[model samples]
Target: MTTRTLGRLRRTDFPYYAAHPDVVYLDSGATSQRPETVISAEADFVRADYAAVHRGSSVATGEATWAFEAARERVGAFVGAGERELVWTAGATDAINMIALGISDASQGLGSAELALSAGDEIVVTEAEHHANLIPWQRLAARTGAVLRHVAVDADGLWSLDEMRGAVSSRTRLIAFPHVSNVTGQIAPVTDVVGVAAEVGALTVLDACQSVPHMPVDVSALGVDFAAFSAHKMLGPTGIGALYGRAELLDVLPPARTGGSMITTVTMDEAEFLPAPNRFEAGTQPVSQAIGFGAAADYLASLGMSDVRSHEEGIAQALVETVTRTPGVRLIGPAPGAERAAIASVIVDGVHAHDVGQFLDDRGVTIRTGHHCAQPLHRALGVPATVRASASVYTDIDDVSRFGEALGEVRDYFGVTT
Candidate 1:
């Protein structure tokens, strides 16, 4: 299927693709290309309304605060969260770390006991998790004496609901996993995982970096305790992401970061902090980046998430077909007919992934190579690395076709014919 048939966005909408019309960008899983509106939103804010938010009583401060809070509301509503439920951070990695460190504080008696971990308690994760989601939990487990347990993946690098169910038990305190795998393009059984976690009274933390930018995600509807996603993965600016927590949980999650702006009153001996978001946001906020994120959300909403999903469905099919049809290529994710995100990771029979990447780069086909920050998953897959191609709203059929053609020529270019 073609992107034209599925109704995709024009490349002209994005400044990067507009400037490099000959380049076929397929790296959206890492970071997306921003639309002109999102860029203008940030630039315009910097030029006209830039000021320190949540401080001082000047008119400039008031306008800045209003814009900042308005952006929060826009982003929250986009993901089915209330205004207070979303907390801004540096990125998804920072958001996950905040949650982990906050829970660590809880275990140390800094906050409410609802999320506190203790010796012998289990923190469940999957083998397919991104390092951002996995390593934080590992550190938390070490700090609290909790055991870090994981659901192992199959030969295809995909974890099943049964595996997830088997991993959680009466001692499970939290379950951390991705909504979609960055390496395998596998869509996780989130609802099933959430159900299993609920059965064991475990909190669910979703790494939504891959899912939110590609499909419709409702953290509340999904029944997760927390979710982490980056604005850059969804066509917004970098250095700004969101942590979606249940309002009650955020209010008591024990701020991992504390400074000016987060507290209402501070004494030499102790301090009293504000509620939810303010408790999490310390120091000066990312005001202009937040506005750009809100603009990206609005742009996607206007384009219709359903339409975006439909378009990516076509892209996924094309990607799978391309990999399956090419000789000497092994796809790392779901089978050709199975449902997946618009991502394809593959290993050429003889050429290294980096070599494949270089060959494609020479053809103006940009892609991600190496472990892709999934060393454990690559070890499990029995390969050192794989080249990954991902799509976004701006990607089209021609871009994918170019990728397929370049990929087909790789083995021959390296003189690897058997």
Candidate 2:
């Protein structure tokens, strides 16, 4: 939103911001702050109605089970998916690992032979991916004897459409990439990547952790076979994430983690698993957290994602212009006026990123400083670390301007004027 709306929201919805007037949080890319509605939804659910789901025949069990399933439907509709497409996981990392490990199991003759990977099959990824997205595929390759091919990023840490196209071929089994670069904030063309994968008869997977929270994302419309994202990043509670897969694909893919409530029938040696959402959810579900997540989705939906994108566009322009105008601060990612997410990652001329972060912290501003779990992207940019200031629905112009002023003073604070 614009400053007016952001300021209004700051006072009405966000308790943390209202309580701590001095602290300006600029780390929404890492994890967004929750609104009062989301906080109360979880607490209210736990306090008023807390019971095990899918295991009992009592009234409490039916009520709790209804709430839990209803939460999934709300979150699913938020992302433009059917009620059955969403599968609950711990977080984005767990969701990605679930797919990778499920593929591993398939290749090892565990469940669906249709999903198996051979020695010559290749899995594609971009160098801009975070470690969570990268490591899972590496392990999958190691376990299945498949080859991993990376679509390398350029000097600005970007993978072009041509580069992505060149990386896919007849041998490609899967093409997985992020919808947005967490470091560069460069938004990728989902349809382009999905088209390339479809041409090569490869399954498409999207690491939608960064894009889903900030902009509108429809997994089914994007034509991707599967997508993963985290609840915490979307202003929802932690310990719960979502994996959206085509019901056809999810039905056959082996469950990475197997336990009670996931199977339809279990006898002596052989057991049959349930369908999509239920098959993936094994143990007692994260009932309260999912309810909170649904409330978060409803909150965003009420504001409208189109308005959210328009608001972030303003923040992106401000962040880029602020960093570039300040001396000793080099802005990363696309040039000004380019299509990018509302995240500003910068490298100071002399001071280290951690020191820059501390410098901001001293001035009552909080930012994220490090490789951002994206060592490959950092290495591509030839930097050890960067200080990233990201924006969200509640971020105002004052927050961005404060970050710019603090960043400009970092070199001077460390006596690095030269």
Candidate 3:
């Protein structure tokens, strides 16, 4: 790894990064700060190569199709999936919805007529799921008459492996869960969970929104049936993401949306959909954004996920130490020393999460403050929301220290000193 390829590790050169001498950003889990290369790549695509892909026979269409499919290959390489296994979607939310919709279609005589879900079948999730993962399964269960079941978490927001193991049974149809929790920073034992599900002949669905961007994720090696993630979280442009499913599984699953590019032949009463990726990616795709996403993936690959994970761990450890030293501050999620992400959620004595966010903002430190789309987890943890500070590859030690100092002053600002 050459230093030039890695670029300067300092907090500079970050696109949309305005360095106030005292300002710091820590809300990377919500959305990461993009680099200049990613921004320029998207701009260049729009400026030089904007055209409708997978349609028409013109030279421009060929170029556009090449760019779009090349992005599929780039993103596929990043996650250890094949080019044909990657399907473009609007975002992670859309990807999850697509999976739910595909399953619904499979059950409803749209495609794969042999596999139909009915009442008494179970769909498993966890108590710590984000609404994106939770609501889709809720609707799937309700619509298909399948019962929804979930593994419970303890007070620390940690769920035991045995708890999940016990939940799987012959009736379990699918298991949808996050590889890493957004609020708790808790890393789930996906392999173990998948093992139990496989024993019951159930499918494994992973919400890799947090894991794929930050770490080196090999979906094939992980043995997941399907996985979903967004581009913006990994320094790519928004409105673009990818879903990876086993080639065999996607070939049989029907796409949620139907349109021009997704079909091969259509008659008055019947239609034949395209193959795995094309079938799911209906209509004109996000070409420019996909191009930019490929660049982002390339950049991250150049940096290497091992280095990214190590650097992020350094920041997380320092931030957790600072939180523990601070008075009247309570750190939520997995305990320190647990395998987790660089995200840390905290609650201050006599201070609301929103108020703490405002206080941090006044100090020029940016952090996320909310339920983080994990309302059920918050409800289980006995709080409405929390203040979260997350890190990315662009983040430096100085940013972590600045945010820690700002956090130290929070209790004093609210006069909740212990």
Q: Compute each candidate's TM-score over C-alphas.
A: 0.98, 0.98, 0.96
lDDT by residue (tens digit), candidate 1, 1-418: 3476543445668889668979989999999999999999999999999999999999999999999999999989999997699999999999999999999999999988998999999999989988999999999999999999998988989998998888889999999999999999999888888899989899999999999988999889999999999999999999999999999899889999999999999999999999989999999999999999999999888877878888899889999999899999999989989999999999999999999999999999999998888888988999999999999988888888999999999999999996
| Candidate 2 residue lDDT tens string, 1-418 | 4754754565468788778878989898999989999999999989999999999799999999999999999999989888689999999999999999999999999978888999989999999999999999999999889999999998878889999889888999999999988888999999999989989899988999998888999988999999999999988999999999999889889999988999999999989999888999998889999999999999888888888888888889989999999998888888888999999899998888999999899999999999999998999889999999888888878888888888888888799976
lDDT of 1: 0.92
Task: Name the runs in model 2 displaced over 4 angstroms.
Answer: none
Best-to-worst order by TM-score is: 1, 2, 3
Residue lDDT tens for model 3, 71-114: 88999999999768988999998988988888898888777863
The TM-score of candidate 3 is: 0.96
Worst 10 residues of 1 by lDDT: 1-10
Flag the better candidate by TM-score, 1 or 3: 1
Q: On lDDT, who's better, 2 or 3?
A: 2
Compute the lDDT of residue 112 as modeled in candidate 1: 89
